[model samples]
Target: MKILIVSYYPLGFGGAEVSMKILASGLKKLGHEIIFASTGHYEGYKNYKLRNYRKIPFFFLRDNLLGNELIKIINKERIDIIHSNGYYTSLAVLKAAKKTGIKSVVHFRDYALACVKSTCLDSSNKEHERDTYRHIFVEYFPLRWIWEFYKWSYIKRSWKKIKQFDLVISNSNPVKEKLKSLGIESTYLANPVDLEERTKTSVKELRKEYKIKEFTILYAGTLEEHKGIYELLVTLKDFLIKNKVRFIIAGKGSSYFKILKYILENTIINAKMIGMKQHEEIMRLYKLSDLIVVPSIWKEPLPRTILEAMQNNKPVLATNVGGNIDLIKDEYNGYLIKNNEWEQRIKELMKNKSLREKLGRNGRKLLEEKHDLKKISKELEGMYKKILIKN
Candidate 1:
């Protein structure tokens, strides 16, 4: 199978990038010919070079112009299957596949199609409201609005073209449900994690490096508000003052600055904002922490960080939303707190080291059973074969 994988961003960071790198590499390992196309270079793919397409201003390019370039790529590559990662990139593949008569598969990694804001929830995460807006409004909206309108138009104009694609793949049940609500049927495929690399960290060394004298809580991912970084910081601040614990945040984002600001203003003592580190370094942090916190306010499709933490035999303390509910078994593998009770929950976990160890063991078992990269990759490969046969 000659597969053409397309993504809008570099593949070194973010959930989408990690997934694509795993899929492309896995496919290659399975004796499939894979060609890559993406917007930028990723540090992870330093050895494997990708063919670069002429960079076009995403906001300024009209629909037809974008479609034409994509069509040319499909025809030129003689691509057998077009696997697109993001929304805009998927649209381009859909357009190109139609013109070139190629089969296409779209991976709906987020809730971009259903919600106007694309986070799968209203600004408040309560109910659908018409005037709801995205958090990064200046960076996304107006352009996003235009893109949304264009997508609608393109779907109407090329309904057959768009629908001819073999399948729509989603990472979680919540994401698939959202797609179904939008009249798009999708298959659920769990994202893959590099379990081999994750399992190599020495827990003893990690604990010594972080100076973890007491129970440590870890949060690894973007510090964005949507990810509930502020909530984690607040919870850590309160939890630490009451209990013997420390919080280590390993990742950087817009909310990193906000967290720094909060730390400075309030003189937060227990929480440490270590900023972004490489993937290997992050794994080491995961090893050090006794528990991992995923306090996302939004309904994340499937957080890769959660999977990573679990794979490292670290217990998770996550908000009960999105695929977190799917991954976590309350009081069994990890503690699932209500969105509002994050701080109180952290404090409870801090006081119970036995519970933390139990949950960590359970989480590791679950990761080995379900979230293993090779296992998930084989499942995805089966799905790809099924889609190709159907098409």
Candidate 2:
């Protein structure tokens, strides 16, 4: 089958891009052809080059302009399917699918399907509220309601168009449930991870080069309060002093100083904050690390970091919320932690080397059974067949 995978974000920006690269590679290996289109960093054919679309009125009509381009491409390439990775581009993609009379599949990855803003009274539970605070756009006194209406209408309109697609796949059960709650029916599909990616560098050499200590914990993401990075430090400060495990925090944000100051104040804690690294660098760090921590306070849709940990045979300890629940099986791959149970879980994995090794192996097994690209390709074909047979 020939497919044109669509996304709004450019390659190397986020997890969606990583998954797209993996998907394209897998599809190509199975004798399927792939074409790509996105917003940034040209990928040969089309680059939407949309900037300032997030402003008041353009955001509502951004997809319409793109729809014409999609129609031309769909006809030109003889594309059989257009698999759209979720974003605000759905209305245009769905319209093109209808016009071309081709099969359409949409991957629902996160909470962008709903929730117009972190400013929607539930800012506390928002996934990336720090982003909201950083770009504090006040609707202001008179026109606040008008801007709010447009945002609300935009999402509501997208919901109406989404049901027109042939199939919608949610990355986690929790996300599927959220879709169902919003009256958007979707099938649950685990996000794909590239199991074949490996570094030629030896772990011992990497340890010496990067000065990585034995029994290390790695956290890679924005250093924001919503991400729970500082909270992770405060939660485990005493434990860090007693244990020899090294905590390495990657990625930076507005809360960097707050996190840095706390670590500096508590000198005995064996923790350090290293700014963001490239994807390849992160994969190497994943190899040197013993444990991966994702202590997000929000209900994250499905964290790619956890998936990467599973890929590297490192166990994940994450909050018991959102898609994190779907990824981690208690006492299986890793512990699905709650606010109060972080210390206890870390202690268990710290003291027992055998237990950590057992859990890590189990995580790798889970990835092979569920998240392997070959398995995902088979599942995709199965779903496509069912859709074809029904149509």
Best by lDDT: 2
Clashing pairs in 1: none
> Cα deviation of 220 in candidate 1 (Å)?
1.4
The CA-based lDDT of model 1 is what? 0.71
Q: What TM-score, over all chains together, does every model reach?
A: 0.83, 0.86
lDDT of 2 by residue, 88-185 (tens): 66777888888889888888877766656421224454343222322224433355656656666667667777888899988887677767877889
For this target, which candidate reaches the highest TM-score against the unseen true structure?
Answer: 2
How high is the lDDT of residue 160 in model 2?
70
Which residue runs of candidate 2 sit more than 4 Å off their true CA positions? 41-56, 118-121, 126-145, 241-243, 253-258, 261-269, 388-391
Alpha carbon RMSD to native, model 1: 4.1
